[model samples]
Target: MDFEKLLVWQRAKALAVSLYKELANCGDVAFKSQITRSGLSVPSNIAEGMERFTNTEKRRFLSIAKASCGELRTQIMIGGEIGYIPALLADRWINETREISKMLSGLINRISD
Candidate 1:
């Protein structure tokens, strides 16, 4: 399947872009990079995984992508707690990541089965 065409991917990509903007102003360089990297990684990994040569490979990458989504979730929570990210913004990304994670899980299950 073309993950690029998937609504989940599309939403994740938009979320990533918004996240990029959100983290850019964060004063801590390392924190911003780490969070942004993992945030961007979620959808990118999903796209790359879909293009893999085997379903096993796809599953592996998708799992990592799901992990990245989880990482993004944690980072957002931490950011909000630390006052780096606002509650509303954090909630938006959290919701987007949760949905994307669910979609990625469904894709992985279908590929595995």
Candidate 2:
């Protein structure tokens, strides 16, 4: 399957782009870099996983992508708590990551079967 054709991947990619733009003016460089890296990883891993020949490899990458969702969520929460990211923006990202994680889980299950 084409990764770009997957809704999960599409959403993840959009979230990553949004994050990059949102965090562009953030003064906390370290936090910004970390969150952005995880945001980027979601789609990157999904694409790499989908292109793999084996279901196991694909699932592995998908799992990584899913984990990155949690990582990104945590970062967003921390950023919001520390005033680095606005509450509304953090809430949006948190929700997006949650959806992405669920989508990844469904994909993983499909592949497993």
Index of the highest-lDDT prediction? 2
Clash pairs, model 1 backbone: none
lDDT score for residue 65 of model 1:
91
Q: For each candidate, what TM-score against the reference?
A: 0.93, 0.97
Off by over 4 Å in 2: none
Candidate 1 lDDT, 1-113, residue by residue in tens: 78888776788788889988867777899999999999889889989888898989999999999999999999999998899999998888788888889988898898963
lDDT of 2 by residue, 16-76 (tens): 9999998899887888899999999999999999999999999999999999999999999
* lDDT (CA) per prediction: 0.87, 0.94
lDDT, model 1:
0.87
Worst 10 residues of 1 by lDDT: 104-113
Give the poorly placed runs of model 1, Cα more than 4 Å off.
Answer: none
